[model samples]
Target: MKKIIFIICPFIGLYWLMSSCEDFLEVEAPNHIITSEVVFNNDETAIGALNGIYNQLYTSAFSSGWQDSVTALAGLSSDILEVIRSTNITLKEYDQNEINPNNTRNFNIWSSGYNIIYMTNSLLEGLANSNNVTDETRNRLEGEAKFIRAFTYFNLVNLYDDIPLLTSKDYRSNALAARNSSEEVYELIIRDLENSINLLGESYLDGERTRINNYTSMALLARVYLYRENWGYAESLSEKVIAQSGIYELLENLDEVFLANSKEAIWQISPAGRGTITSHTNEGSIFIINPIFASLSHFKLSTGFVNSFQEEDKRFQDWIRFHSGLSVYYPYKYKIRNSTESITEYSMVLRLAEQYLIRAEARVMQDNLIGAIDDIDKIRSRAGLELLAETNPGISKEALRETIMEERKRELFTEWGHRWMDLKRTGRAAELLGANNSLWQDTDILYPIPEEERMKNPNLTQNAGY
Candidate 1:
């Protein structure tokens, strides 16, 4: 894999040049290969610049939903997944919680995250300086850019504990920047999401769910608030998203939940962004173990994770598949392993089911046991399981909280780092993982800042365990 540059001048425009060599998109800006003046001069180029960010996301290591992405790496770090190949030492490090700061995958996650941040910062800067761009276009672009930045930082802070928060395109300052406290990062995340909500409209731009909208920001913000322990705000924000009944709903068929533009998706990344004729998502191609390519499969669900789900659970029946030849269970949420046809599935980022879980957890924190049960029941009902309201109506707060956490693990296994982050946020990681694995340590909660990053910036500090 290429070592992605952290600060590339005119990142988005360069992407535009690579994807579609439109001569009009070229601009004569010295020092910077592309400039805000030309890129944001009008709506067409400005939108293209934004699209560049979306397109690049499909290839970015941290967000790509591929083998090296957070979905795989973090899933390995948790108990939900195990690396199938012992020869793959890097992935095994993550699975065993013995990751080294010098690990290339760690570096890729760090660099790729900052690469996207640089694109967002550049977009925001370009929109701020352009006067010719329509107010509508400027506002929407700014909101989306900020949301992306916030989203990136949110993941960075959670993964590495303290990360440099770069909100501008100035490479000099960014190169020497020190890490910001997680609290400071969360403050910016909250502010950016708030601004995104105000600037973005309710409808998905151009009818594509891949584009950020007000509800998308709300869904992410709801998660942020839940992590920050702002229970009331988290509850209200998730409720706002869940209340959009016409636009979003829990799909009765578990198979339809991951399809492109599904009503359940709050935000999705289209594989079309990859600029390739191959339309299947990286998640599908890497995770599904086709018999002919079974030897190439790098990951499989852990035995404990597979056993955690009841035999009758619809999620187990629909979202997971067993390979009789290899005797392994793999994530089947994404059905297409390889395809040349038009895209059918997308890499899901934020979805409606998570909002219900967020709301349910938030309500549990606020002493709204009944309301929390109601929200949890929404997910259970869709899963073809007996509703909590009917099965255990008088459950206590402590037990209900545990139940919600279990539900989250069952419902959101391989999507993102939800299981890993959930264990950390709830302070259950050490207790749970330590009992099962002798190698588990309290300091393993946060991944180390990449050694390459520390070398680049002498001012940067390493996390304690590293």
Candidate 2:
């Protein structure tokens, strides 16, 4: 086996120094490249390697929640967001679902996701070969690395149906790797999450919710099962996470949900990970329209989407903001646009609200109508809407399922491409988006595998209708 060489950079280790987390900051200066042998020789450096992955997530184009991130790109691909500037050809492709194989932004989303996967693979190999680290440290690092890998693969598979599943850091082999079936990719995702759950402890390491824990793995795994339509496991896993009310809960005030370390967050990526003076999350910086710079803003909530919300829905009132100057409503889930103060909001990846919706859908699929309504009402109640149980206790299973889908759209919009992925997974992308988008095609559900990637590797093939 070949040793993985890591180019340790300032941003990778700067996360600890900036956050003042002493335990993971004792490594050497972050300027020089170091081999895996030295990185995994001690506890702190090995941990720093894992920390680097988390930090890079804030910088990675795919997960950063910025204009290039999934939240913005996929929101445009879906109906939730509209491109404020039609001149941006890259974004227009996503908005119209006519993305060219040569589009660089589409390639960026694809390559950036694989970059994180590479880091995770590197960390996993280093941890496996090292005997200098303690068992406790090794297990925790392994679990976190696997969880991140699984998370990245999940997004990639959804975006490009059959993707190159690179599990190891063998560049020679990986450079020429062919795309694997979605089933093959998902098999690895499920296996990784299950192993991660067993390897990790119940509590967040060092009391930081940003760190992956047993429940974090379970939360993601539950979602994976739900997407695969494994209803029993999805319901059971989500039920377990929801039961941990002491650690996680739905905040009564919707405004507090995205705050750093909020009880609502199951897992989050801190803006501190960017290692920049501008502490505001990318989501806020891109989506929130500043009057002075209103002309520069790129995206706004779609008019149809804004109208989809009921008049009394608190999410509509609390999470959406209107700009009279621009005459458009924008997503305000993350409030601070330009701030140099201490970090206040961490980008929400998984939360308690999604679990409730997941369980509701799973239950309805299992024909537990009454139980399903109870779960849906939890989200509806938080939004200050009439409880479904009271308003439509006798609703049929089909109607209840549609209600859950609508609720997910309203609740999870503009967050991690949930709306786009939901439409694809539920087989409704063509039916829903086609009605409005003239460019809609069933093949558009999967982005064209980047043309540049195919050029580099002859084995890599393009998706149909590209």
Q: What do the candidate models score in CA lDDT, each in turn? A: 0.87, 0.87
Per residue, candidate 2 scores C-alpha lDDT tens digits across 1-466 of 1122345643344121221111111233334446678778888888888888899898888999988898889999998999888998999899999999999888778877877887788789888888888999999999999999999999989999888888886656777788899999999999999999999988987777889898999999999999999999999999999999999999989999999999999999999888778899889889999769798889988999999999999999999999998899999999899899999999999999999999999999999999999999999999999998898999999999999999999999999999999999999999999999877888999889888777767888999998
Stretches of model 1 off by over 4 angstroms after superposition: 1-32
* Ten contiguous residues minimizing lDDT sum, candidate 2: 16-25
Q: Ten-residue segment with the worst summed lDDT in candidate 1?
A: 16-25
Q: Per-residue lDDT for 1-466 in model 1, tens only?
A: 1222222333443352221111111222235455679777788888878888888888888899987799999999888999888899999999989899999899888878888887888889888898989999889988998999999898889999888888887766777788898888999999999999999999997788999899999999999999999999999999999999989999999999999999999999999888789999999988899669687789999999999988878999999999887889999999999998989999999999999999999999999999999999988888888988988999999999999999999999998889999999999999887788898889999999888777657888999877
| Cα displacement (Å) at residue 265, model 2 | 0.3
Candidate 1 achieves a global lDDT of: 0.87
What TM-score does model 2 achieve against the real structure? 0.94
Q: What is model 2's C-alpha RMSD?
A: 5.4
Model 1: residue 273 alpha-carbon error in angstroms = 1.4
Q: What is the lDDT of candidate 2?
A: 0.87
